[model samples]
Target: MSAAGVDSAPFVRLTAVTKRFGRAPPALDGIEGIVRGGRITGLVGPDGAGKTTLIRLMTGLMLPDEGTVEVLGYDTRRQPAAIQAAVGYMPQRFGLYEDLSVQENLELYADLRGLAKGERDRTFAELLQFTDLARFTTRLAGKLSGGMKQKLGLACALLRKPQLLLLDEPGVGVDPISRRDLWRMVENLTEEGIGVIWSTAYLEEAEACDHVFLLNQGRLLFSGPPREMTARVEDRVFRLSGTDGRRRHRLARLLEREGVVDGVIQGEAIRLVMKPGVTPPLGEDESVASSRTAATPPRFEDAFIDMLGGGPGGRSKLAETQRSFAVGDGKPVIEARGLTKRFGDFTAAADITFDIPRGEIFGLLGPNGAGKSTTFKMLCGLLKPSAGEGRVAGFDLRRDAPEARNRLGYMAQKFSLYGDLSVIQNLNFFAGVYGLSGITKRERIELMKEIFDFRPILDLSAKDLPLGLKQRLALACAVLHEPEVLFLDEPTSGVDPITRREFWTHINGLVEKGVTVLVTTHFMDEAEYCDRISLIYRGRSIALGSPDEMKSRIVREDLPDPTMEDAFIALIGASEAEEAA
Candidate 1:
């Protein structure tokens, strides 16, 4: 039934909806569907798929050029103001006043939403309690952690008790624990009979929806239960284990098989997908298997990749042109000996220690306020440790910072580069900074354009490009000098599945060519690629092991076949419980 009434109609309806921005391709084109009410409906697609545009049109913030958007039986074109009042919108970048206190921001939004004063007090009390932010009401919004800020944004959007809630990519950059909390809060809203529309890049999140709308290039690809989508890949998935300690090399070779649809490193095994009606090429010589494997149930992610015609398959071009080097000459590439950082009376990172050798990928997993970033900066010479050692390539980060930094390439989480410059201009500028000159500079720029395939839009402003394209440009700039080590901070935080797989293919290739990497990410599936992981909490390393080993630690009689994410949440919970005791 519709959220607007007791009648049996969908929550929102679209009839040949179309939207265009300037002379570029249509943001949304002739889309039609019905989102069910009284539960969560997921909206998912790749970057530039018009997910944001569709959400805006439904909120009455923008009017469509053709067809109609009907929310709660009221036509958007005729009753936009009424539609706006009934809908609660939490956009990609929710407008929050960082300078104000938490309570002040809530008050401001309540006033803007026209809530009655008598009704405001009770609602404020309930919301603050529900979000667990009552104790922090007097704190400045800027001082809150990333998770807290997300909670505050949700509270502000819910001030007027909207009939329909619209959330646009709400989980970007949020760690798994915080993400779980956010999910729980949204699930509670659905139980109250409130219709929710959630747009996200995380396919794991989409898997939990009661109904899903899958879109591509502004057109509907599928609109139904997520189970139906997942069922398309039945009898197609398998996990190959017991390899010869060359997971990366073997996974790359498996991608070239004609019967294989998609393949990635899952812990010690390579999860393989065979095309429909094809027999498994099981042999004693195959690296993907030690023995014949049974078919595993497919996930929403597998189906999503199948619909996109498999990932960017084949070997990485960037890896083939590069020469291999050996850095196994008696020195570790990165070292953190009891690393610790403090801010005033509080500690950010404490007693963190790890050693990374050449040609290995190490992952850091932690909560938002946890000291992963602090430890990373100390190793890069961006910050000094309070009472510990940080070294890179045998050079002390504090004393020989320039020398250490010169040997590494860093790509920050927020796309830290010149946004106003053209794509080619940014490439040229970064190349010069890395000491490339004359023919070397010209040759490298052309090579980058060819490798990343950004030549078609080379003259476009960097800010105007889509998120995936901007990510490519950032990565190209970081590797212009071909440093021996790569430091990636949340490298694929908000990208789609296809782009993520492509990025990892390059990373694995670089590792094979003797480039060590230290990376951080929120996606658990991606974390399986790490040789070892350090799970931090409250400024300390609470757990350290390979992903498979970590999963084994959490297994019990009541539960079996636990995934990497299950281990992550369970270990954090155990640590929290122990600390409290």
Candidate 2:
């Protein structure tokens, strides 16, 4: 099934496909595309951009309102059963029975795919090794970490070795190492001539594919090689970093306002895109005459930002009313001493200690089962620590659980906002529960609407909003009463770059007003926003510091330049090695 052997046939093809969801708009508007044999094609776009709709059309989960879709030369509408039999489809929220063990999940998928018992056993062994799940076969799928769940989901998908693989944001919430492993598996499949159409919001991951289709607001913006698409914006990006935030912010504004820059905020630096002939602004004491021209090629992320009409500049506004809380002699908002949680003989959270300062953004980072959620639960007073002491917002976590819970806003990893309720109704319900009433409740609701741009969807049901908007509404509900501290577990998990940026805007505004934030995220880029971070591995804080401090500590002197990903890999790898020893 090599590309050379199947050069005569396209693995999957779509012709003038259009799908409409009621009268809102066509989710897949005239999406005419083709996937060739032995190639990895990326469907890249922001959330609600029709990537998922296109995938569904090809997978026969939904038929298009117009046109046709074909898989392996079979019409999808007429031959959905044949297409399903020949394709491996993994949706965004994969269906995995929580109660089933890893092995059982794979076995069930194998049986469902109609694999022979012997073939199933053989494939199961290979898949276990490939996904690195052999060690955890007895562990329940629900007990697995976020990365592990994704790996298991893929394992189930690959059980039958279908001719075409359709993955929808397969690496949405996975760690960097897991993502790398998943990509390697995908490359191997494509090498074996199994065509892949991967829909993802992660632009960097999309760069690995052989071809890319850029979708925007249900329209195909560009289709072809990633290199060609990036070439369109080459020599336009300038990397700017400095110690001063005020100066950097000022320069960013100037560049943005001049209409000559395509800027993206990256940690402490600003990646600015300048016009072909424009000169960079010079400081009074610093000379611009000796400034060298930036020759670096545009990254997929840079190109994406340019395509989004550059960054949000002065036009963005911050909330006016201010609420302040003192750290009380700079004491940590949350403090844990020798905290422990165990389920029978299994240790969910080992003896751990940490201090989170008031008005500071603290990041809780770890692999899926690395004790992040357990610790978060303890802090929020949902689960009592098996041993030791903890406090949140000046209330002892164990002794004053109710008091701590009331003072802190908790947004779970799987945020379950009332879908049937209208946006305003959801807000109102949360507001009432938080003790905000009369004009106070009304004022706060209005503030949230303005801050999150929820006015347009006030009367719309929460379930009707897109993923990004849902995340926004969830966040709005969480902050309705303006809790003293916020506990956000993977708040931006699965959100696209644009939505992620917007979410951070609201977060940064809160930080500016001295609202303490304790968040857990799998996305490394978000770790940059935290004032301090603790890298938890196997229920312990193996690394802790500001992003720069952590980077400096872990990066090797031999390496020319190391990124956050490199630092993370080094730290986590070292931790695992020590545990083995």
Best-matching candidate per lDDT: 1
Candidate 1 lDDT over 1-581, as tens digits, reads 23543234876999999999999788898999887567889898888888999999998889999999999778888999999999899999988999999999999999999999999889999999989999999999998888899999999989988878999988888888888888899888877778899998888888888888888888888888899999999999988777665889888887877888898888988888889997556673456446446688899889988888887775888877666769567578999999999999999999999999999899998888898988888888889999999889889988899988888888988887789999999999999888889998888888889999988999999998888888888888988888888999999888888888889999999999989999988889999999999998999999988999999999998878899889999999999999899
Residue pair clashes in candidate 2: none
Q: Candidate 1: TM-score?
A: 0.97
Candidate 1 clash pair list: none
> Least lDDT summed over 10 consecutive residues: which range in candidate 1?
1-10
In order, what is each prediction's RMSD in angstroms? 1.7, 3.2
lDDT of 2 at 223: 89
Instruction: Give the poorly placed runs of model 1, Cα more than 4 Å off.
Output: 1-7, 284-286, 289-292
Report, for every candidate in turn, its global Cα lDDT versus the true structure. 0.88, 0.79
For residues 315-341, write the lDDT of model 2, one tens digit per residue.
334323547665546878889888899
